[model samples]
Target chain A: MDVFFQQLVNGLTVGSLYALIALGYTMVYGILKIINFAHGDILMIGTFIGLVLVMNFHLAFVPALLLAMFITALMGILVERLAYRPVRAADKLIALLSALGVSIFLVNFAQLVWGTETHPFPVNISGEPIILGEVHIGTLQIWALGVSLLLMVGLHFFVNHTKMGVAMRATSFNVDYARLMGINVDNIISITFAIGSALAAAAGILIGVYYDAVYPVMGYSAGLKAFTAAVLGGIGSIPGAMLGGLLLGVLENEGAAYLSSGYKDAIAFALLIIILLIKPTGLMGRREQQKV
Target chain B: MLELKNVMVNYGVIPALKSISFKVEEGEIVTLIGANGAGKSTILKAICGLIKLKGGAITYQGDTISGMGAHLIIRRGISQVPEGRGIFANLTVEENLGLGAYVRKDKAEINRNLKVVYDRFPRLFERRKQVGGTLSGGEQQMLAIGRALMAAPKLLLLDEPSMGLAPLVVKEIFKIIKEINQTGTTILLVEQNARMALSVANRGYVMETGQIISHGTARELRDNEDVKKAYLGH
Candidate 1:
């Protein structure tokens, strides 16, 4: 029972990070209907930005997190303007290829700048593990889960209650209709990228703190996991992404604890295949009807 | 008032609109009647800047708006209820109406417009919280028109509001169109149902292929022999 509880806590902590990163994927997909393959690299870039702020500038945790989020948000917008926007009206394959190009460029660029070394993430927050009964939980895990929950709640309000949120929903429904309703789609797309990237930045920083390490290639695996989470929950559904992330985290952690650690990734991938085979549109995805 | 002087459009070298010229005078229901693929919809797309005009100027109240973006055109008070009643399927009927006033900033005026829309179509008011996709076909049309009206547009462009609807529903929609026009908004209506369109329009343009082949008062076109045989099924 204690082992189960411990694994559950660990799973939730990891799940929270995956959910945050998956939001960027789901949001960009929601608005543009593209996978945004470079999203993981954006997370890596954000981690580096956080590292620079904390390690070099010696900024506090909250300030470093904010600056990293701000910079990465701008980077997302810049990526949209320069890379994604040009191929927006093109075929899906072409846009996807463009995204791949960006991912490659970002990875190589980060490798060149950071020298391919895994650097220790400076712990501005206290490195103390909180013990509850027989289960042990890290403070960073609590912070990560708490912060992510706050962001998710805030995102829910922004997407449901606010004017821009409604516009985003409208745009995703029918872009041309949205335009007819006087919506500036470009501006909305920019905002989606900004918000998605900001969430990713927060996730990146949280992951750095939790793991106590940051590296150029770290985005590849983390991004792949988050992408899977988005697909599991439903690619264009925000709540779906959150659910998928949490579920993926719990399942993977349990698998690792009970089964061989080497098969952890395989177990997750197998679950994805099973879910997709049973429900191709993901858990909460709306099944598309063929409109004549 | 809106004027299109020698507008042209092409979809990658295949001409959609070829030097089409027309004017929509203020407070008049101007119907553009044509068969499918005759470019009536293209003319509306050109007017609203959804498609780039190859060579022409679209002026609204003496301002050149030919190359402006679609959102800017909507901001200039020209809202289009696009073909097939392009309601946001995921959104509620009330939310769709709110989106129609997307460019406007006045909260009180928006509420007033919402009330006006609700009053005009009580059915929509009843289904206000219902998802737009769940509505019946006729109800969807009403929601679409109501959504467009939320913009308080000076000129409303309705493209085939009667398409795919039952005859009874079509009549209701046409009645609503006339009522909306009577409330002082100018209209540019595109329809394949020439009989119904001419009956309501003040003036009409007959479009064939990609150009306006004839233009006259609605009565003149309705009585014309060629129009009677080709469009009226006489």
Candidate 2:
């Protein structure tokens, strides 16, 4: 029972990280209906930036995190303008190919700049673990879970209550109609990228602290997992991404503990396939029917 | 107040609008009526900057706005309630209306506009909390018009406002259009319902294929034998 609880805690911690990254994918998908294949590399870039701010500049954790987020948000806007906007009116296949090209380019660019070696994440946000009767929980786990929840709540409010949020939702519903309402859709898309990238940056820094390492190629695998989480939850649904991330994390951890550790990833991918076969729209996705 | 001079538009290799020309005076409801594929809708799309023109110029208040962006055109006081009443299906009616005032900076004015819209479409007010997609066809059309009014446009463009509604609902919508025009908002309406459109508009244009074949005062267009036989079901 204690072991189960420990795995659960571990799963939740990992799930929070995945949720953050998955949000970027889901949000970009929501607005553009295109999976941002380069999202994970943005996370990697953010981690390096966070490392520089914390270790080289000796900044505090909160300030470093915010600065990383701001910088990554800018990068996100740049990627949208340079890479995505050109193919905005093209066929879906063209956009997909362009996104893959961007992912490859980012990975190569990172390797060229930072080299292929892995670096130890310097700041230790994790302190002593809280001991219960039989379960032990790390301080970082609580912090991670708390911060993730706060961000999600903030996002929910922004998308629901605020004017710009309403505009975003409207644009997502019908771009041409939104434009007729005098909405600068280009500006809105940039803002969406900014917000999603900032969240991914936050996730990157948190995961760096938890794992104690960062590397150029880390984005590839981590991005794949987060993409899975987004798909598992429902690609265009925000809450679905969070739910899927948590569920995927728990299932993968439990599967690893009980079954062969080598098949942990295999289990998650297999589950995704099964879910797709049964419910092609994912668990929470609304089935889309084109309106004339 | 608005003029399209020899405007030309093409959809890829096929011409959708060919050298179309027309003028809309302030305080008059001008309508273009035609069968499906007559390029009647394209004229509204062009005025709102939704599609690029191949040639000619669209001048509003003497400034050429032919190549401006759609959002910029909206900011310049032209708002289109597109065909099929393009309401945001997932959003509530209130939120959809809120987005109509997206460009305006005055909070008090926006609130007042919201109230005015609610007053005009009381049915919309009652279903303000409901998702737009779930609204009845007539209700959605009302919401679409109310949303455009939230922009407080100087010139309103409505495309097929009476499509796919009950006869009574269509009459009510036309009445609201007249009421909106009387309140000093200039209107440019597009419709396939020639009998209803000619009854409301001050002037009318008859489009066929990709060009305007005839245009005159609403009375003259209504009395023309060709128009009556082709459109008015006379």
Q: After superposition, how far is residue A78 of candidate 2 from its true place, in Å?
A: 0.8
Task: Assess the local accuracy of residue A160 in candidate 1 as a C-alpha lDDT between 0 and 100.
Answer: 86
For A218-265, candidate 2 gives per-residue lDDT tens digits of: 888778888888989988888888998898888888778878779889
- Winning model by DockQ: 2
Instruction: Quote the positional error of residue A278 for candidate 1 in Å.
Output: 2.6
Per-residue alpha-carbon lDDT of model 1 for B1-234, expressed as tens digits?
Answer: 999999999989999888998899999999999899999998888888888888988999999998999999899999898888889888899888889888999999999999988898899989999998888988899999999998999999999999999999999999999999999999999999999999999999999999899989999999999998999999
In order, what DockQ does each candidate have? 0.68, 0.72
Candidate 1 structure quality by residue, lDDT tens digits, A192-247: 99999999999988998888889987888889999999999988999999999999
Worst 10 residues of 2 chain A by lDDT: A283-292
CAPRI quality of model 1: medium
Per-prediction fnat values?
Answer: 0.76, 0.81
Estimate TM-scores for all models: 0.97, 0.97
Please report the interface RMSD of model 1 to 1 decimal. 1.9
